[model samples]
Target: MIISEGSLVLFFFNSDKKWLIRIENEKKLHTHLGIIDAGSTIGLEYGSHILTNKDKKIFLLPPNTYDFVMKSQRTTQIVYPKDYGYIAARTGLRNGSKVLEIGTGSAALSTFLASIVMPEGHVYTFDVNEDFMSIAKKNLEKSSMDPYVTQGIYDPEKIGQIRDVDLVVIDLGDPWNYLDIIYPSMKSGASVVCICPTMNQLENLATHFFHGGFIDSDCVETFIRKIEAREGKTRPSMRMIGHTTYLGFARKVLK
Candidate 1:
């Protein structure tokens, strides 16, 4: 499809250099490679190419949900993409699924979930920090995910409004503490994932899973290292994301 005015597009220079932008008229984007005339991308089809001011070729690609997740603005550490797929698959999250996100850091994960469950499903995300919530709202709006997301400030009384959700994702400091409160709101066979940056937290959360009528509990941590591929010089990238967080996954069961 042609890149129309105000259309979101991805300018891919390399694995490390990518820019997500809306095609606004008279917009110029400066990069290390060269200056990109954002307006020039209009009418260009995805998979085509654009030339920078230095005559460097940049790939014009379609922006996907993952693109928005990585490009989302943030004040805090957002959930990494590596963990998103695992959580979705483990929880069976799909179209029309309802998700309760306890910590709306940057809305990166929220945007991804919203994209999958769009036009039918919804994500109710809560956070105590108003400034972070404000940033997340903008990120959600940028990805057009605001329609499927319900942003709310954290309040004990307001949480009761969420019920029968398919998935519960907790990213707070002590996710295990909220299990009792959200247990009634989770559907039978629903799944919960807690993000733990430390082993102690993971062990603590896992113990609660056993005592809280959750079955099939497991915890996993992932690391990703990009390979710098070049002719006769392909090797593992020195810069890598290691040990971002541990994901504790469990499914609710009725006693």
Candidate 2:
């Protein structure tokens, strides 16, 4: 597809050097390779190539959800993709599924979930920090997922208007405490996921899950090992993603 003006551009120089920029007229990109005018990409198609000022081949590519998540601006650490993939699968999140997310940290998971439910469904995310919500707004905007996401402050009254959600993802410090707050928003049999950093949180959550009108509760940690593959040498990467967080899953049931 032709890269339109104001479109997000993925200028890839190589495996290690790449950037995501919006193609704006006369915007100059300064990089180690060379300076490339963002205007050069306006009429070019993705998968097309342009030359940097120093004659480096810069590949025009498309950006995906992973790109948005990795490039998002944030003050807090995000729930990495490895953990999010499992959370999404366990929640059965899909197109047209309504989601209520508490604690929109970096909007990494929010953006990912929005991508899956866009053009049909929506994600409502809230956080107490204005700074964090500001960062999340930009992240979702950059990915063009902002339209499908509703972001707000962590006002209980503000969130009270949202209800009948298909999935609820709580990324708060004391997610167990918010179970009562989110419980009313979730449909019966809908999934609720909690992103916990410590086992103590999970243990606390398990107790709440048992007494809080939720069933089929489970907790898991996801690990992703990268493999270094070559023509002859194939081995695991020296550095890989370790335990990021534990995902707690449960379904809402009648009291």
Candidate 3:
């Protein structure tokens, strides 16, 4: 595979050695042998081996977009890829679809959203903290989907200006306060997705979604378990990432 400059790829050796690597400008990737300048490998073909300063060979391979975002430096907890996939699927996000995302946090989900809603679509992301926004801004800039994001440092509730948006994704601590604001902005049949970690929050939000005329208020969660396989022995891994958060989705209906 031909690796793009910003594509996330893996370096491997001996058929069993692997290291997840993100391609960046002028980076010096350190290995057991020595440092390999990322600049020299930018336009190189995937699966090609590059020799380090000490002459150790390393293989290169590209990683999926999800893996790239997960490995990014995070200033805040990220929405797990499990939740992100579901959100993307249920929201019907695609090129030319406008999206509103509250509580930008580390911009992890924002980056993912931008990747799908590209070309003409734009994601209006809101965050209160400049520090978090700065980190998210840097992270998105390093990805291929940075152009689709627009940052707002104002309170989402106070702004309340999005109209006819295709989707709304809320990751704030208290999404209930913005229900009324979001309801009017969504196009008929548009979807809204919320991420909350606690059951109590879900219960409260369910009530508001129902009264606000949102249909199909469903709650879902994802659990990912990896497996270890070698020769004839294959079994579930000893550890797994579980219960990252609960996802609540609802559709807008005409009153």
Candidate 1: global Cα-lDDT? 0.91
Instruction: Please give the CA lDDT of all the candidate structures.
Output: 0.91, 0.89, 0.81
Candidate topping lDDT:
1
Off by over 4 Å in 2: none
The clash numbers for all candidates, in the given order, read 0, 0, 0
Report lDDT (Cα) of residue 146, candidate 1: 98
* TM values, all candidates: 0.94, 0.94, 0.85
Give per-residue CA lDDT, model 1, range 1-255, as digits (tens): 989998999999987799999999899999889999989988889999989989999999988888998998988998899988888888888999999989899999899989978889999999878889888999999999999999998876778778889999999989999898788889999999999999999999999999998999999998788888889999999888888999999999996
Candidate 3 lands at a TM-score of 0.85
Clashes of 3: 0
Which stretches in model 1 have alpha-carbon errors above 4 Å? 229-234
In Å, residue 44's CA in model 1 sits off its true spot by 2.1
Winner on lDDT between 2 and 3 is 2
